[model samples]
Target: MSKRLKQLTKNADKNFNQMIIGVLIVAIGIFLWADKNYFFWPPQLRLLMNSEWSDIVFICLGICLLFTALTGNRSRKFQSILLILASAAVAMLLAEQVWHVLGAHKVEMIMAVILDAGLLTLLIRCAYKN
Candidate 1:
């Protein structure tokens, strides 16, 4: 690729929003894992410790956020691997949530799977993109 093309690609990959989101995800994960006394505006926003699933899910998302936030200027191969791992974790988390909600039957499980599948496909495509 041309020098200008590479520079543009690098700039595009380095998003401030991704970094901010990554920080938030990591902070939330830490709070959940540590069981800190953090409080939200509304009472409903508080996360309960009914199970460990949420803690695992948040950590996975935080890792994905880090991958997205820090992969800038890295080699394409490295970015691809990180993206694949992150996407897999996200997909697995979604699948697990769907499995748990199956008993409720309040939401459409098939739709959730389809949406997650689409997200996985998009992530894979992004990983392989030049």
Candidate 2:
């Protein structure tokens, strides 16, 4: 194979891997949404019951993955910060399970996951770019 072709192939492989990771994050969000109880919202917004924050997070992750697939830049860190926040929220919700406060703990968890996913994507970009 030509030298230029080899470089292209290598870059493509890297981009593909990044995209896969991004997609995996989104997939997890999908499963979380499917659980029903995890998806929480106000009665007024109940019509969009399934359209939870986690779903939004998943979409953002998908967008990041798409960007990685196309540009391989990994420039922004916003997504990474978002993911970390989401994970922290999940941790809080899990703790609430033991406490059983009957509060909006589950909602908190969902929000956290969404934030975490975004942070995660940003982290991935940071790792690759700098």
Best by TM-score: 1
Model 1, 1-130: lDDT tens per residue? Answer: 6976776556546644444444544564565567543222233434443235566676766566566545463566655565666566557646554654564453545665665566566555655653
Q: In model 1, which regions exceed 4 Å deviation?
A: 1-10, 13-71, 108-115
TM-score of each: 0.45, 0.42
lDDT of 2 by residue, 1-130 (tens): 6976776566567666555556656675677677655434344544454456756676566566545555545544654554444444334434433232244444435555555555555545544553
Error of 1 at 42 (Å): 28
- True-structure lDDT of candidate 2: 0.53
Off by over 4 Å in 2: 1-9, 39-51, 74-129
Score residue 53 of candidate 2 by CA lDDT.
72
What TM-score does structure 2 among the candidates reach?
A: 0.42
Which pairs, if any, clash in model 1?
Answer: none
Q: In model 2, where is the ten-residue run with the lowest total lDDT?
A: 93-102
The models' CA-based lDDT, in order, is 0.55, 0.53
